[model samples]
Target: MSRFTDFFVRNKKKLLIGIGGFASVIMIGFVVFLLNRERILKYAVAKAIQKVENKYPAKLKIGNARFLDLNTVLVTDIALLPNDRPKLMQIDTVEATVSFRSLFLGRMVFKQFDMAQGAITAFKQDSVDNFSFLYKKQAAGETVDSTAKKTSNYGTLLNRLIETAFENVPDGVNFRNLAVLFKNDGRTINMNLPTMLVEDGEINARMTITTEALTNTMYVKGVIDPDNYLLAAKFYGDNQSKSIEVPYIQQKFGATMRFDTLSLSITNKVYKNNQLTISGESSAYGLVLNHPKIADENVTVQNGAMKYVLTLGDHYYALEPESEVRINKAIFYPEATYETRPKRKIGIKINSPDIPANDLFASLPPGLFDTFQGVQATGTFKYRMNFFVDMAQVDSLKFDSDLDASPDFNITQFGPVDLRKLNQEFTHTVYEKDKVVRTFQVGPSNPNFTPYNQIPNHLKYAILTAEDPRFLTHKGFHEGAFRHSLITNIKENSFVRGGSTVSMQLVKNAFLTRKKTITRKVEEALIVWIIENLRLTNKERMFEVYLNIIEWGPNVYGIREAARFYFSKEPSQLTLEESLFLASIVPKPKQYRTYFDAYGGLRAYPRYFFKLISGNMLKRGLISPSQAASVSTYVNLSGRAGSFIIPKPDTTHVQLMDTLQLAPIDLLDF
Candidate 1:
């Protein structure tokens, strides 16, 4: 060590001189690079613009690029022309700050970008959108929200080049007064950003969207985490006079919906393990769902509040489990959820407490409410209902409803009716294709009109047993039939079969058309209550009217006409087998011709259905076991119309068929 030190001491002056000369040379090079920095920045801008133009059919222009400092570059008066359009995007100034450390690695990395005073316009030309590059259509066999791959190879290269241009944006990206215009088909929307600050994977944005065509304006402000797509902070939105136009809503609900003023506030919080919990409350005023059929009675939610919840990645939003919406005097608590599990599903349950009948009537349009013009109703009724759909198949639907009420109701036109005075005749109109054909005299007009006593006992029993076995016992409705029919209809998502009692059917025929609408059903139920509880009609009177007015064939009305049309016989002479066959087609009497085959015999299904009804009758004690056995397993309809003869019952069989007791009724049970 002493020898090395002595050697260095001898060469110390020369070594010091050499080190100073090397340092001077590096300093001179730095001075020269600093002087020519502007030239290098211009060259880089020209090259970037040229590269972008070569990839896409867009032109880029910049008035000048200058250095604000050694670490910052400012570009002024930039304009971008997409296709042949003039200046789709215009910016007054843009500044980027470079990372000094990245310069040592031979890369120009931006630490921040200030993109200010920019205007962008997007429009559709033919079938192509100006900003179509932002979205690539999904290929076949993909879900609706699935991510799609980028379309073009040039897009991939362009994206890489863009990423490289701004490699290290560590601090933030800021925007000021950026105008965005969008036009597509027949709609024009304009949005302006007042300010936006993006930093550390979080963004706080403020914007206002407006449309002159809709007379609407939407103001939105939110803090979002783009990396995880979370609302890390908060979001608030206000939409005023936002008239939404949706054709499907008009078709489905028979209405057009519009919101006059709406406000929403939301907050997102992370619980544990990065689980996101979002809660929000929305309120709207002057909302209307306008329907043409109810021109004067639009369904409206003048002002209402809704509370909701959403969990990220679960693809579902839930409403308050117990929340009530009060429109006028009616209050309904509805629980609803819409979910996505690759496929979509929906469920809704509504429970309403007792509501005044007059309040409900006032909410309905005159076109519907007038159907019960002569009935006086005074009371409250409560009902609960549920509906569900899974995987877009309506077959998975389940709906259940129940109504409870105690009303002081009656028919104004007819005072409390008397069963003994039912001998009076009346006129009725027949409807075909929803139009009245002719006013016809119904009761007592036909010479073959049979009295209730003269009507064959087995025929009466068969109709009662097939249609409604609980007819004499039930005051107005049969709970068992209703439940069964409700289940079937919900499973099919259609009202294919009706579970109406004889009393209800009689009222429907006497006062309403067979339109199968909710309005019709409600009115029918109201009328049934009036007739049963008010004693406007008795069980025997309703059954008699149902028999007289029910459709038997295309134009055939009543059992008397059906008997003559099918067998050229009187209603009193219909044999047990013939009566069963007649009862089988009561639901679709107009299509009865189809039940007969080419050989003019009752088809297998019709015969089997008859046996089913007959078997039920035997089980319910409406018909004797022997009487059911006597009916042939197969119904034989001769080819010659009206040639099938009615078989007379033996003397022993007549007494059994004649003496069957009527079901005892308890009117107060209603």
Candidate 2:
């Protein structure tokens, strides 16, 4: 031990000298590196540009690049040109102050950034687009290393994206004269930003957007915190009279959406245990939407807001139950989940907890609920709905919706149409293409109106069997039928079937316009539910009204007129065969002529419908086996309907017989 200690003492001085020499060498090398740091950074930038050009179908050009200081860079005349297309992006000057420490770690972390006279043009003509190369897949046989690709869950991916986006946002920015142009086919939309500045996490911007319809100026102000993933922004028109119109949607999707002011705030984002949660709030004022599929007229919401908590997992994205939506003065909580794995499923639930009836009524968007616009109500109401669907098992899809009002709830004033009017005699108008085609009384006042008891049992049953077999037993809706309709529609990928019940049909015909739109359908459902649940009118009265107002043939209204026009008889004298024939044509009243051959014989399609309806009726005991078997698909046209049929050869008998024999008994038509 003593000898080792003596040896160490003798070599300690030499060891110290050697260590000091190594430290000096390292310090000198680091100083030299710091001296040439600008050149090294420029070389790295050039290499990055070369790599980008080689990988993509575009070329990156930097006219000049230099370092203003150790941590600042200035680039001039930068352009990105795609092959055989217009330039994708051009910039006059770009200056950035990067974090020197981050650069040493091979990361470009900008502390400040400034860009001026920059423009991006995204053009598409025919099948060619200028910017698609950015998203294009790698070339064939140019394999990417699987090990290099990170295995990430949905939450991880989303978190990474959010972090990257927020982290890249510089603390200070000054962007001027920036424009983005989108041109497709013959349409062009240009967005010009005159000045956008960010200082100390506060943002202010002015943008002028030009489209085919109008030019609008928008102002944006926001506060951002990159470290905390927080952002609050407000976007509004330059003036009260002007609204910011969302461009491209009108030209691309046939929808026009405009708003006076919109405010958005992202309060928090968290990722943990393979789940990502984001909380945010958004509000809009004076929002207007016009779309043919939504409504015939513009739908306007004066004020709307929502506070949302969104969660994303491996196979699902969800709006958590903590989310709340407010329209005007009414508030509702909504939850929705969309899952892609195990099975593609969607679930949505909404709960409005005992809101004032007036608030509920007032919250309805204009034009969407025109009938309820001026209606005044009192008391409180609550509504809840749960809808779930698994794409693989649509037959088992669940849709449960309920709306309840307090016992004292009452409508104080009527709107355009009163719900109680159907209980008494009232004029029912039939519209074709939004034009009044026929007007008839739905009561004893009309000579051709048929009372429920006076209508033939065969005709009533036939219509019920063909249209809504459980109309008498069910409430306003038949969940089984709706499920079946959903299954069939999903299978066919077309809206070829509707699950409307007798009550729904009555409400649609009596209280709603004939325009086939989403708004009309929702209104019809709501009205039916109200009438059925409130017992505003009896089932018999509704059925009577429905039978009296339904269109049968060309200019023909009601069962009485239909019987007289088709068979020269009254509604009570119509036979089962005649009833089925009339019932089959109810869905296609305007195309009734097409159901019969030139010889006035029922076509194969109509025969198939007759067999299907009769078979279902027999299965349900509405008709006996003998009646089902003996029901003929033939109808003698002796009234004015005869004049519309042109006599010709009958050739569908063989096909009709085969279809009747082979088709399934459970098949349905709507």
Candidate 3:
């Protein structure tokens, strides 16, 4: 027992030494693990940086990078594009804490991560011609439209620049958060995303992308900084990837924009095709209108009004006003209101009562009124109405005259007139015969506007038969007839005929009439092409137009005067038979003539010749059967010398809009 104790004492020291050595070895292993951790983290960081450089902007700037734990690191910085410019996306600092525990075992793992203080800013600039919806805008001194001097030359150069800005960013893309795990020997990398925010007071949202190019899964979250407007975003890939300013592409443009309150929160996925499905609303105020025509001189008072809604990328905002407007009255015009909502059922009544009224039925025809009469009427009259004549629901009709007068005629002798059909016509019809001229009247003559319920069915059908038959099937211009006309004109080398529909005719008459040459025809075709894109309905207005202005006659050039001179009645009263009789002389008057008794008294001959014009057009289905029937009613349709008169609207109602901005006009859409 004594010897055992002595040996124990000496062996105790040896045992202690052995114990220390074992502990030292263990400590050394731990130190080695911690020392190489940053290296592993750096390697991972380098790999992630490479991805951003390859996929997005190449100029990634981080403020600093540091170790967060024994096996994890954190990095923060401001990001830039390859061109090195401060832009839409600017991050003060982004913290990416990465772990490297698995690196010692020949693997990578990110254990923890965080990002703070980032934002995205969107701006509308005062100078718009400098901007392009297709790409980021250039700074001052760069002419966006180099062809402003020669608009024909600038598109190519601008396109090249736009291409370069978006070349690296594939159109369809999505990203999500990453996940990683680590063990005793190896570690796992994860790209897990944190929450994110968008700009312009938008709802906050989450973004996830599934893409083959990104190995199919990426998680992304971000929030925009209210103060600086930088998007603080976090991304997670298959591996916990550490990237500096991964969202720098949007920041390349300096914060030239001042946002009111840009907020956003949303979640959506990107597919293999790289399409981002973002479902959220982003609203902004005072978005600059980028129209080139927005000059002070061009905005004062205009011949016509224009409205536009501009769209920037997927983002949209209110387009600014084009004309300086003033509000004077709250009166509503039926034509204007109906134009606003045609399909809806809404009716209003006339409000003002001060408008003086009269019935000009007797004075409406052409031969009866002087040229000065129409002008005197337009200048002196002002109209106020509750509902539009074209939009109102009509139940019955009453005809009365000033100072009490009646026409000495019977229903059977005169024939029934298609009142509803007459209202549908857009033409300015004047009836005139020698010293008797009259224009068609549209209303009850109360001086207030009223709307029409339905175009007279008979007139509608008749005009359809006589005018544009393929109106329903064709887009705007009849293709078959147009092609035929073009070929014939080309072969003949003279401008003779056309198959342009009533819509096309309206386009030619109202929107444009620059030159009277084939080139004008080419421009017309181009305009028609654009109009087709609008898809207009209710096209009957075009067929009703009366185009007899520059005529070769004696004080007679309008439908109202011509009708009154020959038929001794208003155009609205022109029977189907009388209509056919008048329609015959339109193409060329002198070619067709009626019976002329040498004794000067009216006489019926055994064989009389009348131009069968309306008949031919009806047989060809150019007009509706109802119109043909109306033409058949005129017992003695005359084709002889008559009083000349121009057709004009008997009653005119013009509504003054309170403000131009009530509808989107003035700003051009992107």
TM-score, cand. 2 vs. native = 0.81
**For model 3, what is the error of residue 247's alpha carbon versus the real structure, in angstroms, after optimal superposition?**
23
Tens-place lDDT digits, model 1, residues 1-670: 9998998899999999999999999888678768866666766677677755665556788998888988798989998776645457889998989754444434445678899999998887566565553233324332322244433233333334333333434467898999999886756668788887877755677666666533233444444443332333333344543453333455457677665555554433333332344465566666666665443345566556655554333455455455556554466778877777656777788888777766554444344546533333577667787766675564455666666665653222432322223336666677875788656565667564556776787788877776777778767787656645655565555765567887788877877676666667787786676567657667766677678778887677888878878777788888888888788778778666556555555555566556666777677676798987877855555323335332332333333232121111111122
Most accurate candidate by TM-score: 2
- Candidate 3 minimal-lDDT segment of 10 residues: 661-670
What clash pairs does model 2 have?
Answer: none
Error in Å for residue 9 of model 1: 61
Q: 2 or 3, which is superior by lDDT? A: 2
Model 3 lDDT, residue 487, Cα: 43
lDDT of 1: 0.62
Give the Å shift of residue 18 in candidate 3: 23
Compute each candidate's TM-score over C-alphas: 0.57, 0.81, 0.29
Off by over 4 Å in 3: 1-31, 54-57, 69-72, 83-90, 99-464, 468-562, 565-670
Number of the top lDDT candidate: 2
Question: What digit string (tens of lDDT, one per residue) describes model 3 on residues 1-670?
Answer: 9999999897998988999999999899878767766666566566655544444433455555557655335566655444332343445544443334444444334333344544433233333321232243444334334344432222243334434432322212222232221111121222223443333422233433322223223344454333322233333333432211222122333211221222233222112222122222233221111111221111111011112221111111112222111111111122122222232222223222122212221122121111112321111112332322222222111111111112221111111221123233333333233233323333334211122222233333333333445655555655445444444444445755555665565455443332343434544553443344333323443343322221213444544555555666545565654554444344344422322233222222201112233444456665566765454322443433532222332221111121111111101110
Query: Stretches of candidate 1 above 4 Å error?
Result: 1-317, 338-347, 372-377, 386-400, 406-427, 441-451, 475-498, 529-536, 633-670
Query: lDDT for every model?
Result: 0.62, 0.83, 0.35
Quote the lDDT for 551 in model 1. 84
